[model samples]
Target: MDFKVQLLQRKSKIDKVIGEVFKDKNGLQKTVIEAMEYSIKAGGKRLRPVLLLEVCNILDGDIDYAMPFALAMEMIHTYSLIHDDLPAMDNDDYRRGKLTNHKVYGEGIAILAGDGLLNLAFETMLDSINNDPKLCNRGIKAMQIISKASGINGMIGGQVVDLEWEGKKIDIETLDFIHKHKTSALIEASINAGAILGGAEENQYLELQNYGRCIGLAFQIVDDILDEIGDEEKLGKKVGSDKSNEKSTYPSLYGIEKSKEIVSGLIENSLKSLEIFKEKAEFLRSLAKYLEVRDH
Candidate 1:
């Protein structure tokens, strides 16, 4: 199948799983649930979870065993977006071409919605372990990796540094730190978690770690490039928000052409790390190239 068709197929499966889990619960807080539903249901590329499933499939693991992890990753990602758009953070009023969660649901409800989703994600992940006792160890390890990636040492820490350093004219070292922690950490976690669940050997796991690290960095570079020259209609969000927010971006540090070069180099390095997998990693290699030229 073509790459776009494959992506859409994976995304469709993820969406169905997320939607089934996000259904209205009886006697729950309606408004918070509504906000969570809205935010999660918002259109996204579904890159993180799709990548997770692809890695699992590549390693010969059952995709069904990876679905809960995929669902949890998406929830964690959506929660981060909701919080990122709150009054104190990026303070954006629109996401994916619609009112942001905080805008339509109010800040308090939106915060609660984010919290709710975060907690529910863990719940779903932990519950998934019971289905097959034999896979419990891998499930536990995957959950740990996911949690740490989104926790204080990872995404939250990066967000903290980003806010502190915004408009500070930081050096490349600091800029790279922000990108690695804020963006790359979760992507790395997604790939590693899938590998662990799929029972990757120690050497293969190391190679995937390297591959994921490169892709994560390259992914942010692509985002920076898109911010400079992407169509709003295609992105489904305002362009140049990074500039307005005074966020340090690759394009800001290195001009557009240089940024593109950096992304290409990163993709090349990522592919090299995957050479050990040979034909098994074709999807991952294609994904890296796709990121280099993605419009949105």
Candidate 2:
């Protein structure tokens, strides 16, 4: 199948899983539930979950067994976006061309919504494990990886540094550190969780980790490039916010051309790391290439 066709098929499966997880319309705390659904349903690429499923497929693992982890990864990712767009954080009013959670719902409600999603993510993961005892260890490992990636040493820690350094002159090292943790950490978790649950070997696991890290960094670099050059209509958000906030980015540290070069290098490195998996990794390798040049 063509890559786009395969991507669409995978997206369909992911959407089905998401629907299954959130299907119950009748529940307690209807408002909170509604808010949670609103955030989750707001369309994004669903890239993390897609990565989870793809990695599992590559490892010859069961997609059915991976669905729960895939859903959980998306929940975690959405929660982070909710928090990242808070008034105290990025303070943005738009995401994916829709009102940010805080902008549509009050900030307090948005915060609660993000909190609710995070707690629910854990609940969802546990439920998945309950359904299959054999996967408990794998699930546990997935949980650990996600927790570490989303916690202080990972996303949140990077956010703190990003917030602290706003409008301040920062070196390239610090800028890389901020993005690697804030953005790349969760991305790494996404791919790594899939690899682990897919029963990747120790050497393969390490290669995926390296691949994830490189793509994670490249993802942010492309994001920075888009902020500078992409159309607001295509991006679903305002362009130049990074400059408006004086945030340190690759484009800020290096010129746009140099940043593009850097992103290309990272993408090359990411593809190189997949040599161990050969044909099994073709989709992921293509994904890295697509991410580097995607319009949104």
Candidate 3:
């Protein structure tokens, strides 16, 4: 299948799984459920889940075995976005061309909704393990990787630093620290979870880790560039919010031309990491290039 066709097929599967996971339950709090569903259902590229499924395929792992982890990663990703858009954080009022969770549902309910998604993500993964006892170990490891990536050492930590460093002049090393933890952590976890669940060998696992790190940073660089050059209609959110908020970004630190250069370099390194996997990693390679060049 062509790349776009393959992406669409995987996206359809992910959408179905997400819908089933969020199906109605008796006595559920409608407001919180609505808030959670609003953000999850809001259209994005579904990149994290796609990465998981793709990595699993590359490793010759059963895609079915990786589905729950893909869903879990997305839930965690959505939760992060919910919190990131809150009044205390990015303070955004829109996401994916609609009202943010807090804007539509009120701050308190939105916070609860984010918390609920985080807890429920674990529940969903555990249920997946229970259904297939033999996958218990793989599920457990994947969970550990995800938990760390989403916790203080990863996304949360990055958020903390980002908040602290706003409007402050920072050096390249500090900026890298913030981006690696804030943006790259969950991405790294997504790819690593897929590899672990797929039972990739130790060497392959290390190579995938390197691949993920490069692409993860590149992803953010491209995002920074888009914020500068992209249309709101295309991006589906307020562009240049980083500049408006005075948040430090690669483009802010380095000029736009230089930022693009950095992204290209990162993409090159990411592709190089797949040299061992060669043709088996073509999808992953294409994905890295896509991330660097995609408009949104």
Candidate 4:
């Protein structure tokens, strides 16, 4: 199958699993649950989880066995977006072309909804262990990678730096740190987790880690470009707010043309890192190109 077809099929499968997980279960915490459902189910590419599953599938790993972890990755990504859109953060009112969770459910419930998703992400990771006892060790390793990525040293650390440096003319090192932590950390984790769950050997796993790092950085740089020149309708979220928030972006640090150069270079490096995979990594190579050029 072509990469696009395979990508579309995998995305649909991830969406189905996510939908099932958030479906009504007769729980009493209806408000938060609704908020969770709204945020996670909001239409988008569902990129992170698909990336996880793709790495697994490319390694000849069972997609079904990797499904739970893939779903957990998406849940965590959604939770991060929900929190990032809060008034205290980016303060966006819309996401994926719909009202943000806080906008519809109030700030309090939105906060809880993010918290719920984050916590439930861990539970879901554990569920993969229960699904197959032999996978228990891999699940634990995946969880640790994900936890570190989402924690103070990774995403949160980047976020803190972002907050502190907002409106300031930051140096290149600071800017790189912010991007690597804020965006790239979770992306890298998704790739690593897939490798682990897919039973990758040490060298393949290390190569994927390098591949993830390059793409993660490239992905955020594209996001920076999108914020500058992307169509609002296509982007499914407001743009120009990066400037409004006084945030430093790739385009801000380096002009738009230079930012594009940087992205192209990173994608090149990413593809090079995967050369060891030879023909087995074509999907990943194509995906990196897609991320570099993606509008959203």
* CA RMSD of all predictions: 1.2, 1.2, 1.3, 1.4
lDDT of 1 by residue, 15-46 (tens): 88888985766665777888899999989988
List the candidate 1 regions with Cα displacement exceeding 4 Å: none
lDDT of 3 at 105: 90
**CA lDDT, every prediction?**
0.89, 0.88, 0.89, 0.88
Q: How accurate is candidate 1 locally (lDDT)?
A: 0.89
Error of 1 at 3 (Å): 1.0
For residue 118, what is the lDDT in candidate 4? 91
lDDT tens digits, residues 1-296, model 2?
A: 78778788888888877877667768666676677788888888888899988998899988888888888888888988999899898888888988889887788889998998888888988898899999889989988998899889998899899989888989999998899999999889989999989999999999999999999999999999999999899889889988988877899889899999999999999999999898888899889999988999
TM-score of each: 0.97, 0.97, 0.96, 0.96
Ordered by lDDT, highest first, the candidates read 1, 3, 2, 4
Which run of 10 residues does model 1 get worst, by summed lDDT? 22-31
Model 1 / residue 7 / CA error / Å: 0.9
**How well does model 4 score by local distance difference test?**
0.88
Q: What is the Å distance of residue 49 in model 2 from its true position?
A: 0.7
In model 3, which runs have C-alpha deviations exceeding 4 angstroms?
A: none
Tell me the spans in candidate 4 whose CA falls farther than 4 Å from its real position: none
Clashing pairs in 2: none
lDDT of 3 by residue, 109-184 (tens): 9999899999988988888889999988988999899999999999999989988888888888888988899889
